[model samples]
Every structure is written in structure tokens, then in C-alpha cells.
Target: MITVVTNVDLFSTFQHVLQPLTLKPLQVVLAYSGGLDSHVLLHLLARYQHLYPQHAYLAVHVHHGLSDNADAWLGHCQQTAAALGINFIAEKVVLNVGRRESLEAQARTARYQAIAKHLNNGSLLLLGQHLDDQLETFLLQLKRGAGVKGLSAMAAQMPFSLQENCLIVRPLLTHPQQMLVDYASQAQLSWVEDESNNDQSYDRNFLRHQIIPSLKLRWPGIAHAVHRSAELCAEQQALADEIAEIDVVTCAHSFSGLNIAGLAKLSKIRRNNVMRFWLAAQYLPMPSRHHLDKVWLEVVNAADDANPQLRWQAGEFRRYQGVLYNQQQYAALKDVVITLEHTLSQRITLPDNIGTLHLQDLIQDTIHNKSGVDSSNAIGDNDSGCCVKAPLAHDKVTIRFRGEGTCHPVGRSGSRSIKKLYQEYQVAPWLRDRIPLIYYGEALVCAVGLWVCKGYEAQAGLYWHVTRER
Candidate 1:
């Protein structure tokens, strides 16, 4: 039975839902879209704010620019918020329609990313997702053959972003959409109707308009039942996550890398669970079952000496030295040579998002009196503290990603090829070309953070440092 809600009952329910959250007087931001659901929520929040004036209220509208009336909708939201005496902020986002994902998915992602900017560490973001929305989401995930985590649907309350410490709360999640309509009608509220909502081309609209209405006619309590099932799935997912957490600790290596040996000890199902959890921790997109199987059969199970890699749209998985590493696909740097003049202190920005290079004059007091020491016989220091002799006025100094010939680094005996030096220093094969190499004309002088050339070592002169962007 769908019971009509009075204005007083709606406000009271809103207050009851948010009572626990008001203890700290946190900023409450409503994702206001000037639609029926959000307008009702904003009206209720305005009434609640009158009683609990300690908590700050803000209405944020994300302009996706997808609809023709997007600007008009923004104006309506601004006017409504001003009348309600709540702070208002509007953000415009550009959607990448060319991506492989659906337009609906792109819009939702852009909306949240735009809204996430205004949220502080402890801010509360209120969404207007009601029971009907939850039902549609549940059915959509079910149609996709989702697992427990996906079938759980939208959470009523969850951390928006762990790094931001922001909480997203849906106060109206338990309430029916009809109840919101009733409250809005009784309150004499005016809200905009999005034409896109009636477009049956979208999956959610098809479910909402054609499929769900019949389902409700057959089973009036279908929303409640679906909500209950989603809640059960959420509970089961929480338990699975707890198990994954324990397994991840045992399998993880160096921060982002996973030890293949430790992973091989687990069963196939448990191993996949750990992989999903590990990828989530790295903020990488979850791979499909086919892709995940490829990761296991092709990458992790590859021969110890074979270099295997798997690339996806968001990120890639690479196996090196018996460890699986999830890494972003960085574009290959071009052979762009950058000239560095003799300056006391200078910072050079590398292309292709490589990072900045800092060059500063070494203090004279830090230099050891090596006049008695033979310069050619001195070994070069491979540590970051290593400094190079300042280039002469006629010296053509440059920075390059490609280097050749032999380099005798400090603290190392004799000279070795650049490739040999890379292997000896344990530099990853993928990162060897990315390391900035300092050159005096054609001769390699310093490998930035790796080592300074033996004869070019300065007792007190310019020091080179490279800071990676990623």
C-alpha cells in the first residue's frame, strides 16, 4: 500500500533520518537538480535548517550541458535556493561523449566529479535517490549479471571519497517517490520536469516507464522486496570485503605490486577476490571476467623470466620479477632534448608529464679538499647527493632521455654501458628510458637521481635532482 505523505510527516521523516548526522554541525550539501525529487528534499531541508540552525546548508547544481534547457534549469535552481535562504553553487562539467561508456554513465560520473570539488573533509552530501531509484538500479545491475558488490546498488550512506573523508547520505532513500510527489503537491511546490526523463531510449527510463509500472501492478510491494534484497547483498558484500582485506595484506608487495607467489597459494576464487580488492585500492577500474581471466592465465601464470603485460582503457597490469604491478599507462616520452645553461639555481620542466628537474649550486663548504686526490681515479657517487662540475661557458649542456656509451658512476669501479648500469642499479625495464640523463654535449654526464659521471664529479658545484610527476 502506497500511503500519501503529508508535509508535516515528510519533514519529520527527514529530520529523523538526519538527526544522528547533525551532532557535529557539519556542512550539508544537497545535489539539487530542480526536479521533483530534489525540490521536495530541498524544501524539507529548509524547514529542518530553521530548527537546527547550527548546521550549514548548501545547494549544489551540476550543469552537464547535455540538455537544451540546462541553463534555464540552473537559473531555476539558483532562484529557488535564494528564496529558501540556502547557499548555492553551480558547476559546469564537460562530458566525454566519445568514450566507449554510455552517455548516461558519463553524465553521472561528470556530475559527481563536479560536485566533489565543493565538499570539505567532513562535509555531508545529501542525494535525492528514493526507493524507486534504488529499484531501477537493482534491476539494471541484475540485468547485467552483477555480483554481490554490484547488485548492492547505491548505498544510502557511504564515503564519497576516502581521501576526502566526505560522506554521501540519501535521506529520502527509504521513502517512495509517490510520497515525495504528495509532499510537493501539498506544499504547493513548483519543480521543473526534465524532457529527457520521458525518453525511452535510455535504459533507466525504459525500466522506469514501461517495465516497473507493470511489475508494480503485479506486485505492489515489489520496491520494498527489491530494497530488502539489495540490503542483503550489501551485507554479504561487506563480509566478502572483510575476507579480501585479510588476504590482500598477505599478497601485497611494495605498495602497488602483488606477490605472485603469495597469490598462487590461494584458491582461484579467493585469488580473484584479492585481485579485485587490490585493484580497487589502487583506484583502477574493475576488469571484466574475461580480462581478469587473462590477467591470471596470461600474466600471473607466465614463466618467471617472461615479461608479460595487459593493458586496458583505465590502467594496465605488468608482471616483473614475480610481482604483478598495476600502473597507469603513461605515454612514451619523445626524444626532446632540453638545453640547460650555467645558472646558480634553475628548474627545468620536462615534457610528457615527466616531472621537474632542479639544478642548484652546491655550497663550497660542503666540498672536500680533493686536490691531493687524483680526479680521474676518483669513484663517482650514485646517491642523489652526488654533484657534477659546473659546465664551462663553451660547454653545450643538455638533458636527454636517450643516452649511449659508457658511464663510470661514483663509488663504482671502472666504466660500464648505460644498459649494464641500468641493470646493476635495479631500474625497472619500463622506467629506464624515462630517467632523465644529463649530458655535456654528446657525452653522458649524470643520470639525474641515479649517478654522476666519475670525471665530472664536482667537489662543490651544481647538484641535479629529478622529481617525478606521478
Candidate 2:
């Protein structure tokens, strides 16, 4: 079995798995740790690259700085990759652990982000997680009473980003830890053994050192059986996703919201499934069973006139006026005011990475001619809010949030207070305070992106049009 774990089996596996990749162009990056598993991965990939020279093979090592010998491990990875003629890069990231976050999880999150920086639109990130690692994750999820998604464990292939363009492929997921050790031995390859792995205080380390060995002693094929069970869970998850896809199309009308009525029609199990897909689509954290139950009963089944909400560790969901809105409450956006420079077109980065504010000045006649024919070549939202006459040569323009009083909005009947208008428009409460109010001195000009005050409507000359993009 040790001899069978040679480079021959490794290369054969790579060839069989990557045959589809030759159809399109994409960079393959190995997540090298200079550990036994990853070292074997890099060694095999370096040899296989000789045959498939058409593909780019690179290795990335993230120096988490969690271990005392992290610097030494990074150096070894660089030297080994250089000797194999493989392009190597190293990134150092600090784990920002808040009061609620654990160091282990934070380090993993930071490490993945650091590595993802090097990947491009169609990159393939190869992870070195193997069968033994999968078993540890399975047991951990089981102990926590995780749902189907968690029980599925690590996938052989998965989208690494929300855009689904980049992929994370675990090529060694089927191979056992001992096979990697033997393969490294067969090629006389050397690697690091992290001291932290021996620390049983960590959940995975405890499972690896304390529980799994004893289980394997009783059932020799325990690892393989657990992996097979994980595969079955993944299949069930896929089927559930298919059901969610159909239901999501019915309830999911927009990117940021779902239709309340459509969701109410789904069965409890189906509703939870759709909710999971909806949250996952937006890259929000998945809530647990208890929180999800509260969301279904309170949020999904609330009265049409009632505003019901639920907050979990990841985010919050609210239902209002027959619509459901998903809010990432934990990701606090800066509540600061940004000035609008009227002198030129500019893009301003919003606080808390909300998105960018796009400001461009436009001319009224340039947008549409007096005869209803296209006239001036200026851009406009065809509304008074976006069609303000350009600022006077001496006017100092600015943008801010929160204001009071009444004004007739563009394309509305009668003047109304901003507060009443907010209720009339059925705007989400969270957004009412965050909307940017544009001002030209004492008089209100426009509610950026929402409405333009009546008196400030553009007539003929150039005006400012502001938009926000996420």
C-alpha cells in the first residue's frame, strides 16, 4: 500500500480529475503549507506540470503568524517550490479576533482571504485537505448537531467566491493521511510537522489525536465509511438545492429581498431550504436550526401589517409590507457624512464598504430636446432629482444624511413631509436614516438616489445626478 502511494497514483489522479480543465484557461494554485499532505501535493503537481505545460501551476503559502515557527515553515515552502521550478508566493496576514470570534476560525478566514488575492477570475485553488481531515470535520459537525450542509463536510469541488467564477478543488480529499506520508517518503520529500497539531485543546486536534484513532482501531475502514456518508449528505444537499432553486425563483424577486406572500406558500421544510439558498446566494452566514425556526415562525408567518424580525449571529431578516428584507446588521456601516464636490465627476467610497457613490453632472436639454427629440448628449435619470441645473460657479455643494420638514418630490402629487413620504413609500426603516440628503445651502436639493425636492428640480442647464453602486 505504501508503494502504491507513489507519484504514479498521484499523477494518474490529477490527470483523471483535471481532464475537463484543459477545455478552458485557468490558473491552478496549490495551497502549500510545507506540511506532509501539501508537500506531496506540490511534488506531484510539479511533475504533472511537465506534461501539461499549457496550464499555469503556482503555489501560495499563507504565513498566519499563529505558530512560533511560522516563518521557518514559510521559508521551507519557498525553497521547495523553487527547487521544483514552481512559481511561489507568500502572504502574511494578521488575524483580527474580536471578543466574539475565536482565534482558530479567524485565522482560517484571514488565511483564505490572503490566498484569494492571488487568484483571478477563473483561478482554481487546490486545497490539501484529505480523507482523514474530512473525517475530523464530520465528527466535529456531528458533535455540534449540524444540519445537512455541515454534515456534508469538505467538497472535492466548490465555488470559492460568490461570483462562482473561481473554484476550490480538494484533489487529495479521497486520499488518506498515511498515503500522503508514504508518498512523501517514496519521493524522499521533506515537510514540516506543525507543533500545534499536537495541542488537543483545539476541536479538530482533539478529534484527530484522541477520538478518531480509537474509533479506527475498532473499525479499520471507519474513515472510508465516514467519507462515503459525507458523500451521501452532499447528494441530499444537491437535491434540496434543486428544490430551493424552483422555490427561490418564486419568492426571490430581487437581490436584496424576497416576496413575503410567495414564502408563506412554502412548507416549513421547503421554506427553510429556500431561505438557506437565499442567504448563501448573498454570501451571508448560515443560521442554525434554532434561529432558522424562529425566522420561519415569526418572520415568515407574521401578519401582513406587522413588522417581524429575527437576528442571528450572521445577520438579521425583517418582513414589512408584504416583502422580506435581509439585513447584515453585524457589518456596521460608517454613519459619516460625505461631501459632494460639484466641480467634477467623481466616485466616492462609502463608509463600511457599502459601495461607491457615483456623481456626474448632466444638462437637461442635452438629455432630451424641446421637440421630444434627443438633444444634448448629457446623461439623466429623466427626473428632476437627477436633472438639477449645474451648480453656480461659486456654490459650495455638499451631501449629508438625516433631515426634517416637507417638500414636494419630483413626480409626486402635493408637498408632504419627508417622514410621511418615507412611510408612504414603504421604505425599510433601516434605510430611512441612511439615505443621503443633498443640499444646496439652506434649501434641500434632492434625496440622493431617492427623490429630488420640488423646488430644486432641474429646468434647462447642467445639473448633478448621483447614484450608488454596490
Candidate 3:
């Protein structure tokens, strides 16, 4: 068994993956579950630790807090790590297995989140999934009727920006489960067995126990053949990615929305492909086939003046003001206001959603300060002299919402309605009400985020400063 392990040194195989990615001074974090496969990996890693002193490594076991033996298993992992002279980290995570989300998806999400927290740039998270597991994943993708990218299954070395600079390397992807088990038995390695593996409740387990066995007996090389199919899918995906990059460059607009005319110019097949590719790039989940088909029809077939709107769990897409806008729900804010006295500066923390402000100039001394400066001492002859000085008075500050307001910008005496001002500015109707208008009691001093009221406009030889949290 030692000879077999020596001959198939997983460490050296991993090295080739690392050098190309420059994933070194390597910090290899194995997602150790105390199960047979990961246990074998931990054992192998410990064996080669001395040879790779420059590489930092650890065994991370995520205790899902699901199974009853979770505590015991965590303890076992700690003991094993201590005995083997390798560092061990255990994360106790709450699993949110909802009715809509499967046990497999929930567990994978929680486990990856836990591991990701520990990884920094240039580090790698290793999973114990072998060739058989890859074969199962490929079959599952087919069951869902996934596209080429999904059928590509897992990559040998995946670089994830979990932190500023990090990469995840799966060295065991090419190795078969049988080979790992054989090596473990030959070397007399002890590992915990998860009873869930035998539970047919899980789809992957059902496939492994019932479907794969029958298929393998008939084909004898089903796993290897399916694995090859996944590789071919991955190669096709590379070509698709190149083409998608070209499409993205052509159709993407200034506001990160799609250019409707440019998109319409593409061939129907390419349009659909590029739309799916664009949504996926934005981390938006794909809609159903029928929904996508509808989307294409609404965008391409509809009259130019037709108002097109579509929604999905990920987000909504609407054709408005000549641009295709993909939108998400924004955080809302409480209506509040703070009033600042003339010649006084104030620092105000804004609510999550209330950011913009509508304003009116009230007094001759009132000044609008757009200077990006924090509250400071008021110098009588300093810039922002028309507004309050820094070290603002505490008592008079107040916050209020924009209701009816009117203001004449500098060089103009006639007041324009706040509603008309916003329209002229082209502020989206969805965003206009959310902008907070700052008031010093009854008087509007400055807008929380947007322009300060023209009356309170900061000017040279004036003594006022305004501070806001971005």
C-alpha cells in the first residue's frame, strides 16, 4: 500500500496544477469530512508534508450540525490531525435545507462558504471528489438537461477569488474512488464512514448505488466514457466562451445594460446564446427554456415602441427609455431629516436607500456645499463661507423627506418645481422618492446625497462645510 501511494504521489500531480497558476508558497486546505476519501487525502498530505516544507496546509472539517455524530466526528478529525502533525480547523455551520433547496445543494453551499472564509489569495481548497464522483455529477447535469458548461462538470484546478487572491485545486479529480480505497486498505488507514452515503434519499446516492452499478455492469467502462464526454463538453465550452466575449463587447452599453439595437442585429441563435451568456456573467440564475424563448420574442419581435417587461427569480428585465434594464430589489431607507444652522457644519449618516435630495434656496446666507470635505472649523473668510462652518452646532440639525419644494439655481430667480428638476435631470422615477432631502427644521439645507440647496450653496469667502457618509 505504501508502494502504491508512493507510485501515485498525489502531491506531485498537484504541483503541476499549482506552478501554471503560480498558486504557490502554497496553502492547500483539504475539505476533510473524516469520510473515506478525504481521510485518505489527509493521510497522503501528512506523509508528504516534510518534503514540501514551503507549502502550508490544513485539514478543514465542516461540521454541518446536521447528523447526530457531528461532534464525535469533529473530535476524531482533531485527534487524527494531532497524531499526524497536521493543522486542523473545524467549522460548525447551520445548514439551511429549505423545501425548494435540496440537502445536497444546501450542504455544498454552507460547506463552501465555511471553507471560503478561511482561504486568502493564492490559497487552494482541495475537495476529495474522485473520477466516479465526476461521473455522477455529469449524469446529474444530463438529468437536469443542463447545457455544455454544466456538463463540463468540475475542473482540475479552479481559481476562485474567495479573497483578494485565491485558487482552489482539485488534485483527486483524475483518481478513481476504487484506487483510493485500495490504497487506504493496503496501508491500513482508518476512516469514518458517513451513513448518509447509503441513504437513497439523496439523488447522488441513488445514482451511485442503483443506476451506476447497473450501467457499469453492462458497459464496464461507463464512468470513463462519461468522463470523456464531460471533457469534450468542456472543450466546446472554451470555444463558446471566446465567441461570447466578442458578443459581450459588441452589445454591452454604458450603464451595464444591453444595447437593444446591437442585440437585435445578431442572428436569432447567436442572440439567444449571448443573452444567456450575459445573464450568467452577471451572476443571475438562468430562467426556463420557455421563459428565455419569451424573452427573445419580447426583445426582438415586439414593435420598437412596445414596452417590454420580464421577471425571474434572479431579477427583472425591462426595455425602458431605449435601454434594456436588468433590475434587482434595492434596500429601502427610513424618512428622516436634519436641519443645519447658517455658518454651521454637520455630519449626517444616511439610511440605506434614502440617498438623493431635492432642494430650495431659502436665505441669502444659505449655501449649497458640494465640496468633498468633512466638517471642520468655520473660518469667517474661508471657502463655503455662505454655508455653516465646520464643527457644526449640534442642536439645530434635522432631517426630513422631500415633499413640495422649489428652488432657483444660481443666476436664475424663477423657482422650478422639484418634480420638474428631477425630470430634467433624468432621475428614474423609481429612485426619485428614495432620495432624502436634508432640512434644518423647516428650511431645506442640503440634499442627503445629491446637490445642496442653491440657497445654501457653498461659496468662496463663506464659512460652512457639509460632511456625508458615502
Candidate 4:
């Protein structure tokens, strides 16, 4: 039932929703769009702040620049925030209109990204999505044949995507749009109306203008019914997530991948559920049903000797030696050779996020220490078993990603191919080229973090270490 909200009832509703949150004296940011719903929320927050002045309050407006009147709307938001005695910030974001996703989605992503920049950990962000907006989202997800997670619709409160411990809260989610309108009318609020809202080209606008009004007329309590359904879906999804978490703990491999053998023991339904949960944990986009099926049939169930992979837009799933790995798509590393100065102690930054190589000139340090050991003797000896040798003064020391000939490592007796060594070391195939190969002129010295070539073992001079980027 749509309750007619007076000023007192509206304030009571706001207090009832916020009281349970038990919010500390944190930064409270309101997403004020200068629209009716947000304007009503802004008024209620101003009143709430007046009563409880412990929390810091601010209003932020995201200007998408999609509408010609966007500048005017921003001005209205600024003026209204100032009148309410709240700090205000306006962020302008560029939208990728030509992208495959709808313009509405692009605008929303850009807006949230802009807002996320202003928030710190544990900040509270308030949105103005009411029950009517929730209904629209639920209907749209249904149209797309969504599962429980999608059908759960917009959550009343959720963790902010960009910041840990930050929350995105919609206090007005349980109230219908009529309540907001009634409150705004009673409060004599003024707000800007975006012209784009009337355009039926957008799916949301079409639903708001045509579909929902008729539905409300036919079934007076449809909004509450849809809201109940969404809440039920959210509850069911939470239960499924719990089961997936327990399954993940059992099937997790040592290398941060899933164990296919362990997964095979579970039923197909449970396996699929666990796979989705695993992908989400890796922060990869959820794959389509077809792609998920391909992961099971082609990657997980492939012949033991044959490598199998299933790729999607954001990432890929690959099976290697009974383990399933989820990897985000990375750009191919170029064959770039970098020269290093052996005379000085320095750090070299590698390309393609491989991290840095630190070279310490032990001989230089020993000379500075005025030690009894002769520097010449240290340079001449080649039996220290260190991963890197002190290079000759005229030797062109360089680093490369690829190696040519076979190498006899310091601990190993015989020579072997680089590929064979990597296999012996159990290195994944995709990471083979990313390993930095140290070289003195054309002779391979060491594959960092792996092994040093027997001929290039250091006697007592330079030492090298590799630190990978997180």
C-alpha cells in the first residue's frame, strides 16, 4: 500500500531506516541528482543531520554531459545543497556512447566511478532508488532471463565496488515513488527534470512511462509484490553463496586454481554453482550459460594430455594438469631487450608489469668496506654458486624475455632446453615468456627466480633478485 507521507511520517521513515544501521561518525555522502527522488532524500538527510550532528554530510552530483541541460542541472544541485547547508561537489564524467553496452549503463558506470573517487574506506554513500526503480530493474533482469543473483535486483545496501568497507545505501528502497513525491510536495522542494527521462528510446524510460503505470492500475499492490519477490530471490542467492563457499574450500588447489578432480565428485548443479562463485572470487565477469557449459565439456573434461581453454570478454578459463585456472586477459609481452650497467648497484624496471630486477654490486660494497679479500680475486673466481656473476667490464649485460640455446643450471649436471626446464619446474605454459632471462652479451646467465646457468655462476661479486608486481 502507498502510504501518504507527511513531513513527520517522512522524517520518521528516514530515522527508522537509518537507526538500524548504527552508523558511526563517518562521512555521509548523498548522490543528489537534482531530481525529485534525490531532492526528497537530500531534504530528509539535511533534517537528519540537524538532529544528529555527529556525522559529516556532503552532496555530490554527477554530470554525465549526455543531456544539453546537464550544466543547468548541476547548477541547481549546487544551489540546493548550499541552501541545505551541506558541502557540495559536482563531478563531470565522459561516457563511451559508442560502446556495445547501452548508453544508460555507460552513464551509470561513469557516474559511480566518479563518486567512488571521493569516498574513502568505511564511508557511507546514500542513493535515491525507491521501490518503483527496483521494480523496473527486476523486470529488466527477468527480460534478460536472469538467475537468482540478477533477479535479486538492486540491493538496499551493498559494499561499494571501488572501496573496501564503503557502503552504497538506498534508505528509500522500501517506499514507493508516491511516498517520495508526497514528501517533496509537503516540504515544498524544487528539483530539475532531465529531458532525457521522457525519451522512450531507453528501456527504463519506456517502462516508467508505459509499462509500470498500467501494471499499477491493473494490480494496485504490484510494487510491493515485486519487492517481496526480489527480497526472496536475494535470500535464496545468499544461501547458494554459502554452499559455494564451503565447496570452494574443499576444491581449492595449491596454485590458487580449482582442483578438477575434486570438482568432478560434486553433482553438475553444485559444480556449476561453485564455478560461478570461483570466477566471482577472481573478480572475473560472469560468463554466459553457454560459456559455462563449454568450461565443463571442453576445459574440465578434456583429455589429460591435451590443454584446453575457454575464453570470454574479460578473462579465460584454462585447464592444465588437472587444475582449472581463471586468468584475466593480459596484453602480449613484446620482445624488448634492456641493457644493464654492471658497474653500479641499481634497480631496473621491467616491461609488461613483470616487476623489477635489483642488482647489488657486492664487490663495490666489499671495496668500500676495505675488507681483507682482494677485489680482483673476488672478480676472478667463478665458484660462488650465486645466480648472477659479476660481469666483465667490457661485457654488454642485458635482459631479454626469450632464450635460444639449452642451459646447464648450477645444481643440474646436464644441459636441457628452456621449455624442458620450465616443465621440470612446473611453470604454467602461459607464464613461460613473462619470466625475465638475464644475459651477458648473448650467453644466458639466469632465469630470475628459477636457476642460474652453470657457466655464469657468480664467484663472489654481484647478486640479483626479482620482485614481481602484485
Taken over the whole model, the C-alpha lDDT of each candidate is 0.81, 0.75, 0.67, 0.80
lDDT of 2 by residue, 38-79 (tens): 888888788767767778889999999888999999999999
Candidate 4 matches the true fold with a TM-score of: 0.74
* Pairs that clash in candidate 2: 366-376, 388-463, 389-462, 390-462
Residues 1-470 of candidate 1 have per-residue lDDT tens digits of: 12334754877778888898878878899999999999988888888888888988899999989899999999999999998888999999888879889999898888888888888778988999999999999999999878888889989899876326788889888888998888988878899899999999999999999999999999999999999999999999898789899998889764257888899999988988888888776556678778889998888888877888888876778887677886665566647788866555677888766667777665532354323222333324344434788887778988888767787887788999998888776566676677788887788888887888888887666777665553
Superposing all C-alpha atoms, what RMSD in Å does each candidate have to the true structure?
A: 8.4, 6.1, 8.7, 8.8
Model 2, poorest ten-residue lDDT window?
Answer: 370-379
Question: Model 4 over residues 139-227: C-alpha lDDT tens digits?
Answer: 99888888998899999999886666898899989889888888888778899998888999988889999999999999989989999
Which candidate ranks first by lDDT, i.e. highest?
Answer: 1
Let me know the TM-score candidate 3 reaches against the reference structure: 0.72
Task: Kindly list the per-residue Cα lDDT of model 3 for residues 133-166, writing each as its tens digit.
Answer: 9989998999988888889998876666344456
TM-scores, in order shown? Answer: 0.74, 0.77, 0.72, 0.74
Candidate 4, pairs of clashing residues: none
Deviation from native of the Cα of residue 381 in model 2, angstroms: 11
The 10 consecutive residues of candidate 4 with the worst lDDT sum are: 378-387
Candidate 4: which stretches are off by over 4 Å?
1-8, 254-256, 331-427, 431-470
**Clashes, model 3:** 33
Better of 3 and 4 by lDDT: 4
